[model samples]
Target: MTAATPPARVGPGRATWVWRRWGVALRFERRSVLVCGTLAAVVALLGVLALGTGSLRLSPAEVLSALFDPDADPRARLVVVTWRLPRLLFAVVCGAALAVSGAIFQSLTKNPLGSPDVIGFASGSYAGASVVMLLLGSADYLAVASGSLTGGTVTALLVYALAHRHGVRPFRLIIVGIAVGAFLSSLTSMLLLSVSPQQAMLVATWGAGSLNGLGFEQLRVAAVVLVVLLICAATVVRPLVQLEMGDDTAVALGVNARRARFAGTLVGVALTALVTAAVGPIAFVALAAPQIARRLTRGATTLRIAPAALTGAAVLVTADFIAQRVDLPVGVVTVCVGGVYLAWLLVRQYRGGRR
Candidate 1:
């Protein structure tokens, strides 16, 4: 890790590192790199703790040895390699995905509260899941996953349609998203109400969310989707950094604001949708991760996605560890903690007169 670098200059002929597709170049800060490494290390430690602290406990060293040595105890391997590893992996990957999604929205809207959860994607996903699990009476994984993807895509399109007049304005987008999100949440509630008691209870339990019983197959699917989205996110980061200087400035500097918004929103929604489909809506990871990442790296002006992604992984992995011990759904733990952070942010905003 080294000292952070300043922002990159953008133009037709000059760049630090230019992408092939346009006159796009990326700026990197060493601090963001350091933050990612530090957060990754933190996540690794928490992962070890999560694996070792369960009922069939093992030492950290034992965990490592078991991971490496193929001839290690079958029971140890079964628990660590098979059962625990999938959930642990999902915790880190999905956490990063949610945080990155949050960062994209925060940049687009210039609002700390802007996130997929608040912006209707999560509610849309839950509404989708409710349709499958409650209305269609199907608890199959494919059914729920397909429902979430379709619902999230439709919701994104709906929000875009409602927000776009001359073009999509970030403020209007957020306002419309919140409104749509509320409506979807209500739809979910109505579905819950209309279901049989047993079905409702099952849906409510899933709504609280869990990583339990997540198989490697699910991880494989999520990993593939996340990788593609992350690549898209990387490409859009340059334009997004320009967008922070104001839409007109971004356009003047050769960044297409509409394309940036479209790319960012699409990637962001896909990421959150993947997580929601996998583990249900783990609340507030998206809303808080980017801001936390910004603070961690002291708010790098270069659109700070890496740090945001790292911070998200740490938060979710740590939250999962706590959730396991407390016998609560990971969603509950995240929501409780996120609720406190939200309250504090609101109070601070009120005091700062930003409202």
Candidate 2:
């Protein structure tokens, strides 16, 4: 093991630490480390709280025992592991997935508000799932999941095509996404109106997004998919970070700006689609997590993927915990909470523009 080298750069109250060992160098900022670590701890604590506070109401110790000790009480193990654990894990994974997706889009567009929710990917996904539920009348998880992925992918392609005048510019992509999303929303509403009230209600309930009945089966597949998507996200991070500095600068630095944007967009949409497919369109996590993470880290770095992911996990776990107590869909909790945050964000942006 090599000794920790001194920070390469230092400022008034900031330093960038670089650790090199066996020909691999890792760069990190202290603030980013602290923020990511704190968020991870929060997520873990919230996960325990969530696992412990269900109908049976196990103590934290009981939850830990049930999780780790195979010889724990049968009932306790059944409740914590067989029942509540999947939902908790889903909240964490889905939240992280959504947040990372948001980070990618926001970085690509260089806009705070650029998220799958705002740009129509979520809407498209919901629309797709609604078609499976309403038209096909198939409530099978796999069928609906396929519809969602298809719908979101097609919508992204459409948006990309429309936005590609010379190249896929960020501003144009956002505008096109908004318009496409609106169209998809209206189409979904029309489908709902055309369908039986029972079908409409079913789709609506799923759209509300709860982690009520998810089990290890669903979690297993989603975890695998998220891992793959996140790895792809990692591959694009360096180029995306360079692109954040402006296309000309990125080009000067030997980064492929257009390719990076396209790859980032693909990965971001896939992440959103993964979550939407698993639990329906849980709104605001994708929109709020990255921004919240960025602020919590005080903009320590341009690409705050890890912090955003951890922040997202914490936010979703916390919201799911609240939802479990209140018997409401987790999406409802997020919307109510995220709506206020969105309003404040809009006001702040407006004021900033005026200044």
User: Each candidate: how many clashes?
Assistant: 0, 0
Q: List the candidates' TM-scores in order.
A: 0.88, 0.93
Per-residue lDDT of candidate 2, residues 140-179 (tens digit): 7778778887888889889988988977777888889999
lDDT of 1 by residue, 239-302 (tens): 9988988888999999988888878878887788788878888999998888888887776442
lDDT of 1 at 350: 83
Q: List the residue pairs that clash in candidate 2.
A: none
CA shift at 259, candidate 1, in angstroms? 2.4
Superposed on all Cα atoms, the candidates' RMSDs to the truth, in angstroms, are 4.8, 2.0
Which parts of model 2 are misplaced by more than 4 Å? 6-13, 164-172, 300-302
Over all chains combined, what TM-score does candidate 1 have?
0.88
